[model samples]
Target: MELIDSAARAQQALEGELGGERMILNMGPSHPSTHGVLRIVLELDGEEIVNAWPDIGYLHRGDEKIAENMTYTQFIPYTDRLDYLAPLANNVAYAYAVEKLCGIDVPPRCKYIRVICTELARISSHLLGIGCFGMDVGAMTVFLYTFKEREKIYDLAECISGARFTTSYTRIGGLANDMPPEFLPMLRKFLNELPATIDEVDKLLTRNKIFVERCRGIGVISKEDAIDLGLTGPNLRGSGVEWDIRKAHPYGGYENFQFDVPVGTAGDCYDRYLCRMEEMRQSIRILQQAADQMPDGPWNAPEAKIVLPEKKAVLTKMEELIHHFINVTQGINAPPGEVYFSAENPKGELGFYIVSKGGGAPHRLKIRSPSFVNLQAIPVMAKGHLVSDMVAILASLDFVMGECDR
Candidate 1:
């Protein structure tokens, strides 16, 4: 018997026992339910799922290979496109790798700014995660509520840097510029108002019987399986393992911030949702503390050769103008070395590995995207579940194709 026929026969028999029809279905590569360009091949007996396989790489952009020909600092802009929802996390990860290779310390104020922006990105990401998850469940009202809060975060981000999304604010050593005087007060207002909004979301979904019934025991994975499948972010935490790059590895002064890591006992969709909710609050807490303790200092690193000369200096000093022109035209020259740096992105661990050849371009660069890693577990989680439950599983995984296929 052929494998396909045997599988079909088995499905038919199961469907006969259940008094329903059996079919094979492709969930995505084009379906909105998949979130990104992911395809899940599902074997189903009526609405009950027999097995599932995840097909990826539909949106591959060759980003890693493109990084190989660009300089370390020049690669920052490209990083913004991956996981477009949290570009600063990507920027910080790539810059931290280059900084690690050069052995330079970021200023205290700069560290605070990085923390603030990254945490804001985390909140932004969680909002989308919750909103999209709600959409998957046919609850459009929850989506509106979650996205309404998301807009406030985006507006705050836009106020800080001119751009709302894909704000390339992190430079090699520090921020592109200092925070505006009004930025702090605005953020304080946001922090004060966000908790109540979060409670509203919780009231709508967290305790609802239908939402709980759909998510509670479905798509369960053990801690060992989650680790084996390379799960991270809320997915890994949902399995009751407390492994956060910020808390475990402590990059970009995350050690200085006081925050709690939320964990869940049952590795299911409901647990993942709750973990994200707790994380949003924790991100707000970190932002509040960082805002209070923000220090005063020069924004960028003091390296004339690596950092761009001041605009005022460029206008007055002939040498500064020449340096500025050269820096802009040719880009920064990184030392001949390789480094791998990872950050606690909202999804999971977003890592950048760069190989420099002491020139204006990188010899090689590779990105360890969390979306890619987290998406791999879908098949494992979706197997033996109802076909209707596949949507719940995918929503829980929260795979973004931009980051996955990059």
Candidate 2:
């Protein structure tokens, strides 16, 4: 009877006393829950989070500073490192920013091709996001299904840019080259095959009791908080704010395509995951329309001063050769002006602000990275949730530290 009484008291002490003692825990700079060099300092009372603080800057990437020192033309490759998962989107966004400063619009063909590139990048990003999100929440089978589709995207990227990763495929006023002849049929085949994989993934996880229980009503943030926190992309949209830079202010032929922006009703982790899934479906529609309406014309702008001359002309004609030499030695002659351009990147809004002083390089450069902004909402959303719930929340936010650190 004395032993039984002692056991009962011990259980009560663990249940009540331990819950009252506060503890400070570090989630990472290298832990899986924080994901990619992010550190979150958590104040916990037993298993529940009382407060959380997110720490960044583990990468030490100085991409903005690099842009200020180099020629405008020289910075295209660096943008690829921003959202390394969506390098094509980064390339296009950077190109648009520079083009705005130069005050030149690329050809219709160029605009259409850029749309294709950006959309492809979007699909690829969302695929990896969904796959990892499933795996993060214990739906491991979904990861394999999504990656199979991603490989085809890599194949497409390789075909177009001659590199599957970090495709420095865009210039200030145009692309590296026109799309290869084989590209369209390949794209069509991919589009046809992708939906089935998406359906398979959807069936596996969308209503799975385990996934729903883990994700639903977890890490919720209000619409007001999202906007006030300056959230963009799926995080912002998941909060039911209907804002997409592509729709609000369309650039690079996005206006021509007809597609709906996916918005979530509930501002929770599950909503964010739903937004990404619907977004991929919308991307497929946009890709089909862009492919169908692919314009026929010069892929690059005709401006000799802004766009590089044809290689054959550069080799044969003295005037063309001079233009080529000037372009290679000195960058495009940008006027003294400041411009800010933001694109609806897969992660969110990737904005570039450039101040040019009539020179090859920018006088000032700043990047408004989505991941950095999205990470700000962690403390607000994470409070009052269990420590284990963080894995699902972080994966749902779907941030890449490459861009966040940059």
Candidate 3:
């Protein structure tokens, strides 16, 4: 009885504003196509959407606040939970921010290793994005093929980080360890095979009548509005903006590599999909270059205070033992300052803003999550499109709720 009454009230409120001809519907806080716990309030005139409002925050874990309590190094694993699809990239972004705050420059080998890890993560993330996007649009075979490739990348990740999923492989001034000898050969094999798979997926979907009809010219966001909404990554690039954090800011030795950033003119779902596909090729190019020119040197910085000392040194030298003890217990004492660092994550620009008062823990930590920001444009994109078009747009946006609600 009460449930009926609440429904009556909701209908009354909706009707009062939108008239009897229009109906209000809730798409999801649980629907599979939403990709996460995203609820959209839709005002519909038959099958045409008159208005769409997105209600987020279902996956919020208070990640920034949690950073305040843990030491800089301890907070790395927490970053994995944000955009869990690209944990390696998240680890590097956070570590780079903290390193910048502390004025620690990682060794050449460490930089190249980080580049490899980050690019591998990019390919892995885009594979899932493309697969899931295809699945959302009824191309199940694409999902299967992309997942097969993604599993190979996951194997490579496990070889490098010793963890397939939550790889907290980066440290403040270096990596957790150097890449194993076998890792590069496996990566080369994956890279060599990836382009053909990309081409296959492209052939399957890029010109399919159903895919083109569903994706092309739908959920269009103009270049002006995309910039105004602060969209980044393939989403912004799909709108014909050439802004990529990797090229614009050039962190993690990205300046040393050469690659083209793919851009789209239409700013529609199809363009976004194409941008992701081409970006994968570019990532492969980066990985190959980094591998070819990788320098031979120490993987971690020699600064014992910032980076952990070698295990043998800790065992043999009293000073090394004390430094390890102090570092493990209190954390590295970063200088008092604030720094904002952003990396071109697979989803978008994953940024970390850190304020340190010369302590092991951050005074304040803030995350500029791309998913959260890009999600704001959904209403503008989905307005006037059919309810089904909303699904296509959301998939093309390629947002992860973990990062969106972080």
Q: Which candidate is the best by TM-score?
A: 2
lDDT of 1 by residue, 1-406 (tens): 5556777778967667545556888887888788878888887867777777789999999998888766666778888889898877777777787778777877788788888889998898898998888888877788898888888888888888778887887777767777899999999999998999899889989998888888999899999999999898999999999999998999877888899999999999999999999999999999999999888877677777777776888999998998778777777777788888888898898887777777777787788999999988877888778877888888887767899999
Tell me how far candidate 3 lies from the true structure as C-alpha RMSD in angstroms: 5.2
Candidate 3 local lDDT, 232-268, one digit each (tens): 9999999999999888989888999999999999999
Query: Where is model 3 poorest over a 10-residue stretch in terms of lDDT?
Result: 1-10
TM-score of every candidate relative to the true structure: 0.93, 0.96, 0.94
> Which pairs in model 3 have colliding backbones?
none
How many pairs in model 2 have backbone atoms within 3 A of each other, for residues 3 or more apart or on separate chains, i.e. clashes?
A: 0
Q: lDDT (CA) for every model shown?
A: 0.85, 0.92, 0.91
Q: Which stretches in model 3 have alpha-carbon errors above 4 Å? A: 1-20
Ranking the candidates on lDDT from highest down gives 2, 3, 1
- Which candidate gets the maximum lDDT versus the true structure? 2
Better of 2 and 3 by TM-score: 2
How many backbone clashes does every candidate have? 1, 0, 0
